[model samples]
Target: MRLDLGAIAKAGTSKANQTGSWRNFKPIFHQEKCIGCSLCKIYCPEGCVTMVEKKKYTVDYTYCKGCGICAEECSSSDIEMVMEEK
Candidate 1:
């Protein structure tokens, strides 16, 4: 017998699973350095980054996978990835 599985994952299903629990490094947002370009939010693969205000952004650790995409994509170099204490 053969099992059939779709190639693409269903949309909005990732929210049900919290993938941030095992991340070794987490992205830190610097309020002062941020230029509010929204690069971090646009590049996040897990869709964990969010905009708090016009020039401010925050990350939802519950769904963030610590992939460093946010930090790399930051136009102002405001996001930093630091080792998780736990």
Candidate 2:
């Protein structure tokens, strides 16, 4: 099966929008591993994690310090800390 390049491009754009500040810091959420628990949101000292909807969370790196607390406290091993590309 051939891949749809347009769809891939759109998906990339959507991911970029969802993950703001791609140049500063990034939070990689492993959805398959995420158990829909809100521990990350609770442990985030910066209060950057927000529930966009039920069972869905987003990190606001615009204020995040890349402290990795979310990744550390994620019982499901879903959250990961990643450095942003310069």
Candidate 3:
């Protein structure tokens, strides 16, 4: 019997995995406190952060792994890391 390796994965396949539950801590954005430095967007490993309007940024939690890189890179202390709820 020949092994059909070609049938393994289909093209443009989407994963059903949700990683938000894996986060120990979540980031809280303080929009008012943000200085529009773009540091959070620049440093985000997952590229979840996006610019909304003229220097303001918004984070998409769907792809965020809660690595805290955004919080660490925030020179204005705009992004705060808080523990995730069970």
As for candidate 1, its clashing pairs are none
lDDT of each: 0.85, 0.71, 0.81
lDDT, candidate 3, 16-84, per-residue tens: 455565789899888877888898998987667899986578887776779999889888888889998
| lDDT string, candidate 2, 1-86, tens digits | 56896645444343334334433546787666777789989998767789877667778766666777888888888887777775
* Superior by TM-score: candidate 2 or candidate 3: 3
TM-score of each: 0.80, 0.63, 0.76
TM-score for candidate 3, residues paired by index:
0.76
lDDT per residue as tens, model 1, 1-86: 45457556568885788888979999889877888888888888877788999889999998888999888888888889999998
The local lDDT score (0 to 100) that residue 27 gets in candidate 2 is 70
> Local error of candidate 3 at 78, Å?
0.9
Question: What lDDT score is found at residue 19 in candidate 2?
Answer: 33
Q: Per TM-score, what order, best first?
A: 1, 3, 2
How far residue 58's Cα lies from its native spot in candidate 1, in Å, is 0.4
By lDDT, highest first, what's the ranking?
A: 1, 3, 2
Clashing pairs in 3: none
Error in Å for residue 85 of model 1: 2.1
Specify the highest-TM-score model's number.
1
